[model samples]
Target: MQFGDFYYPLPANEPVLQYAPGSKEKAALKAALKQLKSEKIEVPMYIGADEVHTANKSTMHPPHQHKHVLGTYSEGDAGHVKKAINAALKAKDKWANLSWENRANIFLKAADLLATKYRFQMVAATMHGQSKNAYQAEIDSACELIDFLRFNVHFLSEIYRQQPISVAGIQNRVEYRPLEGFVLAVSPFNFTAIGGNLPTSAAMCGNVVVWKPAHTQVYSAQLFMRILKEAGLPNGVINLIYVDGPVLGEECFNHPDFAGVHFTGSTGVFNHMWKTIGENMSKYKSYPRIVGETGGKDFVLIHKSANPDVVVAALLRGAFEYQGQKCSAASRAYLPSNIATEIKKKMVAELKEMKMGSVEDFTNFVNAVIDEKSFDKIERYIKNARKRDSGAKVIAGGKCDKTEGYFIEPTVIETTDPYYVTMCEEIFGPVLTIYVYDENKFDDILKIVDNTSPYALTGAIIAQDRYAVELATNKLRNSAGNFYINDKPTGAVVGQQPFGGARASGTNDKAGSILNLYRWLSARTVKEVLTPVTDYRYPFLQEK
Candidate 1:
């Protein structure tokens, strides 16, 4: 078939649904939740077109109600990881050689499906599986996932449209080719959109992928795989498997076909994988691309001139939303001493008024952390702060309970030291630590904030003075990948703020933008000669 010039529909951010009480969306979401709770699902590994099952199985449970079983997933071992890698390699050549327009169309179709028909299902899966409330689910599974697919298509086209300048007698052209081998996409449980994006981003660039999503996220992940399949993604082009991470990592990292990894997880895991890939570098046909986003001890700094209400609101939303499971969640705060007492009073009052429970309860603003391990970690941090007599004190909501689910109160810890453990560490839960600073020492505190953490993912500065804002903007420029002027650090829109951080945070490749798609491709330049010279002798040799 002849290739046709193709232009995708202009992309737009998917609108987030409020799912207000008594609204149609609210009713539909309730029905979906009920259906999900009523039934138990069986998720299998997809290698090529085959649905493979193993003897091993793991039960899926919601973090809000741990006793309630949502489903079971087949857990594959090292053998299955090898099988997935082989399946991806088997499908690599045909998928890579397929017409670019055809490849783009599949993902575009998937985005359309997600935007309309499968919208509620995606949101529902996120809510039921990932413990996100309706609004959170809408923003993540529905909105962000749709944006990733559509924007990546636009970006891929842009990559292809890039051409080289040619000399008078020669015409030069550039082609964006997929990686020579398969990609291994390792996604986290926090964002369903991320789980979908990491795998499809590579696939959209004409590369095959062996995707292994976190076990906690596989429930929504199953729906994502089905959507891709229905959108006409050919079997084996993207193989979805559920396996132990270490086992899978060992198999994929040692395989010659492993071309790259698109990872979003903890720093420790990414570091180990990076070291393993480096040690096994000679075993691969090509150097593998490592694009990762890891841990972040994000921050929020408020100047004395800032509005207390605005600071409180930003803290409440940025630190407590989704129970602070976001890598960009504001974990540390630096408030001017003059306004610190007022901000703390209002923050504590609001924290007391806020409701925390299951996501099914729309009235509740906060939900449980992802699992028991996370809850325990957050609790340990709070407990440790309470025990310390000198550095820090728990000022509000320091309680935790795991009887019903993995629930940790929306905690606020006030610290005397700017570099307190809570301020420096990535708690990854609903915990915010405040360190009040003198109004005159804003510049000194900015330096401390910048140097305090190994992470530099997301951070915000709230100040009314234009000079203060400008100074912080310039001083902390390298402190965060997504920096905000007067807003919270969380809730980064896909296309507008191409997210990802530098230093310990990640490679800063900026997912949800053209740069991320560029990582998955290799460029080839072709120069065509219009005319050939018959004489081979040079004038310089004869005339000199």
Candidate 2:
């Protein structure tokens, strides 16, 4: 079986298509969107070799156009969760024992199919189902997902090659064994790439997975599931389910075969899962690995010496791209007083030019939030800021309208109080809260930035002053896991900047890197004596 050395060399990140006007991708994407919209799809839960459907079903619609139905997926109870777990466990031995090269090639082939054949269809699904604009859809569903599939293969290969050194007349190697049981992949609605990565990352390591996507993201999630099947993924290797969170958790957490969880969502949920696992530690076959990336109150700190124009662009894109739904989105800001006025003026002017509407239109920069619940939560934040006694003033785009879709204008709030609720909380929307600091008190403001939020996820500092950048980087080292200099705080590419954070932002396992892959693996040190043992006693026992 170990006849030859097989290698999966590091792969380049997939190129993001621009989808320019009149381009082939644009045309293909438009067609895909039209075709998808014209038809209604019935999505079934994939459990083992069965497509399980139930009388209880949930319909999906585009977040930007709630009136139009996209599809309906089967909703299951606790029973389905048990079925999924059982299916995963049933498939575990064969999947885990399969040759590593064959396992790697299956995902590699999926990446190619996504990059070429299913590219437009995948992008269109994200655009319609998640309300992401064309560019965002292309980047997330098409490009990033492809990169995750490809890059993870290379990352895992690197892990496999790391064998321990052996001494004379002895051979030693480390076997990266998959966890003893099944993994649970709970993914959020924000990023399609995250949805794909969560399940496949565990499965790529020869572990079977029970994947549960956010109800709102199942449209694209199901499509990716089908693609995986077409790419030769066997049934029960990754069981896709749609079930309520509590029902799923009660079953999986209580199951003895629970091996680990690959999660991306809120800090509250991650903490609860960790607590539940701790409470049920004795019931599990092995200690369950928990890897999660959670919430953030990501920030942008500007210096007086920074260019106002650069700050305006960074603030606009960082705070509003994908409607500020990213965990790494710039939600709070500390601006120097010297440039605040000019920056605010330019930011408002730019916000005015931005088009807010459905994702079907190629020109719209801001789209709707996820759903009605998210829309209301965001509206409350804006309304709270507008209160006369709140010490925060809406500087630009505070309008909220859900007449057509869950639309909230790209809003900017300037607060006199540094401790304003809007400045401290994780409002995952397009409402950015800014606090102006005196130019002379840059060092003091850095301290405030560090102490303001419980999250240490992502933050940016834009300044021409090198010393200012260095000072902020050093002083606010623990404030953010991903720090940007002279740039915005969002847009982390796979394999380049490994993403995740500490301190209330989950485990900081750094997805998109080998660090995350290690979570699903249990290493076994294999040692073989080349020289035959002639005696029962060792040299030390015989001599001394």
Candidate 3:
């Protein structure tokens, strides 16, 4: 297998598993999903100053329906936020008190249920909501989530028990403890696996979660909740709500009962929430823990000694995968002048053959941007690029079909000018912009990349020479959370790649590892079997 080639099973043309025949839970969930689809969920609009004209802000080109995962939305204007939080809060004590084994069993059962019954449906929902083609969506929603579940089982089973250690004069021991209150998981729309695992891990650790999934991915989020409930998890153990960012984020930040937040979103919002918690630190009964993963303007640097084929393939996948919506997606590339022309030709040829169309088309290589706002951002960037003397000419695509869906052609821009906005900014689209640099300018190019963004999510360097590789790696030590060698920046595997970034990205590093679970909790020491026998008083315990 090639270095950057991650194995993902191609999605089957038909559903792989059937729901249990005539099961009440299945029937109820299906009915709720049907109702959600039947009702044209009000698309919140922005009212004009005159109070008469209202711009239709619902810009989802292919309008997506809410999923059946989290049950139905609340009937009134208040919606499900309060009710969901209350459910999780009410179940907190019972969930926390349950044996770690039993809690782990519930998750195990849920994982089994997901694998057997909802895998196909979940993939379908992810495809529908996020425009991730069937194969990619299945990999994210089913395959990856299953891995996370299995890993969590192993993680908890192996480590939940107390360990004993011998000391010269005393016995030493260590044990894991659960958080005192419920956890809040606010996930983004980009990755379905993250949307599930972020909150699920907290629940696995005996922390109840008040999860608010991204609005754009409501369906898949709802489906995940259903799978959890069907797996025999107590109703109040996992509370899910379909709420807007500002409203739910504010409630979570200000609530006295809030324990911790597992967030994945934009840096601006993450910063705002962090500031809010810091300002109101004393309002909570306990300090509210914060963990998050935010934005990235990740880069891929190719040294003069790098293989042309390897560089092209990695750059293509890194820049265009999931339409370049990933935190680790390669948004910029710095090519050594020696191979710059050859690499550009190969990339252009490969990208030219890439199919760009509706995500529903199984063969489509790239799909629509998430929404109109994102579409507008890319549009503005392209417009600005064109305005700049067409120096950064579109090498392959610049067309966007806005009739029925918001689909932008997978675009490639060629420009050596580092000053181009397209070269420096995180466009977050299937747009790859190349910047060529002379051999002597490699270090200077690294400096330019470091200073380009507030984000430090992920980066890669392709080189054949050991000295070049080591030098590039050392220089880019602080440039990314995940540094790749001769590989693409996309396709983070569960249990292997620890996914996160530094600087403004996020606080909680949700790297699909057991280590991330610690962020959802605080440490507590228990002195077990305290003897009545007299012992030497500790110097620290005794007042001086």
Candidate 4:
């Protein structure tokens, strides 16, 4: 097949459907949900082309409705992880040697399938499994995953086209090869798109992957794998396994064929994995490429000149969308006292109208946390804030209930101290903390925000004044990887935003762009001389 001469069309970000009242998408989503609710799926571990089952199994339940069992997934042990790694190694040679255009076509087909025939099903799986509302599920599982597939293909082409400059007598070129061995993709539970992207990004670039998705997200992950298989992805190119994290880590990190890791999850887990990989560095064939996107203490800083309505809206959407499960969700806010009162009043009013419950109900704006553990942790934080007399006070919605499901009401805490525990820590739920700063202390507050947390994932500056916006933008340059002006600090689009952060957040690989694709590549330079110097360079001595 022809390679370099072929040009695939560049891809734009997929448009998100609203799924509003009486919409066709809404009707389709409800049907898919009903169909899923009627059956209990049996998910298996995919090793090479084989679907492997184990005696050990784990039940899958929706966070918004924990009593309902959606399915049961086979849980693999350390042996299964090793088998997955072996399968990837076995398939690596042929898969990597295949033409890039053909590999790209497979993923492109997957994207098309996701957009058309499987759109409602994918969204429904996300909703039932992850407890995301219809709109959130559509944007994440359907649009975002499609965006990753299409955009990464375009990015791979761009990388291949990048060649070194040739001198007059020498021809030079650079080849972007996939990593020498298999990649271990560890995905998070929050976004189905992330679960899909982490593995497929490496696989699309010709690297075989041993993927272990978050245990809670396995149901949707299964659907993602099915889509890839249907789109003609070769067997063993990407192996999916459901295994305990520590068990998988021990086997994969110590393996000789472990070439890289593509991860998205907690900071603590990422750091521990990094240390483990370092300790086992000598066992690997080469230094493994480590790429991860971890936790965030994202913020929104509002200025005195900001519009109250805008500030309220940004906080409402940024802090509580998807029940604040997004890695880029705004967990803290710094507001100028001059406009804080009005903003608070408007925010409280708006939040009171928000419905909270199951994803099955389209009217509910907020859903339950991922599980009981998440609900308990967030409840503790809110409880502590409510009990505190000195530094913090509950401004709105500080109640929680776990009877039917792990539900935590969307809460807002106003703190006297800027360094309040809720402000610095990442609760990973629908809890937002506000620190109203003096209007004159904008610069000082900026410093406080920058130094408050170990994370720098995402943040926003809401200001109508151009000077304030520019000042905050420059001052908080290192504070957030994705910065916004007059906007919320969430909802990072694939191509447009290119999301990631530094410091404790992650390696700042900038997923959804060429930068992330570069992480999976190993470059080799080639130079060929037109004229052979068989006489061994006597010209220099003669000239002297």
Give me the candidate number with maximum lDDT: 2
Report the lDDT tens digits of candidate 3 across residue range 142-259. 7788777767766665555435755455555665666766788888889888888878888887888877777776657767777776777776777666557777766777778878
Give the poorly placed runs of model 4, Cα more than 4 Å off. 1-4
Name the lDDT of candidate 3: 0.71
Model 1 vs. true fold: TM? 0.98
lDDT of 2 by residue, 46-136 (tens): 9999999999989999999999999899998999999998999899899999998899999999999999999999999999999999999
Better of 1 and 3 by lDDT: 1
Q: Which residue pairs clash within candidate 3?
A: 67-219, 69-222, 69-223, 70-222, 291-508, 292-508, 499-511
CA error at residue 377 for candidate 2, angstroms: 0.5
Q: Mind sharing the TM-score for model 4?
A: 0.98
How many backbone clashes are present in model 1?
Answer: 0
| lDDT per residue as tens, model 1, 304-397 | 8999999999999999999999999999999998999999999999999999999888888888899988888888999999885757899999
Candidate 2 deviant stretches above 4 angstroms = 532-544
The model with the greater lDDT, 2 or 3, is: 2
Q: For candidate 4, write residues 348-368 as lDDT tens digits.
A: 999999999999999998988
Q: Which regions of candidate 1 deviate over 4 angstroms?
A: 388-390, 542-544
Worst 10 residues of 2 by lDDT: 535-544
**Candidate 2 clashing pairs, residues 3+ apart or interchain:** none
Q: Against the hidden reference, what TM-scores do the models get?
A: 0.98, 0.98, 0.84, 0.98
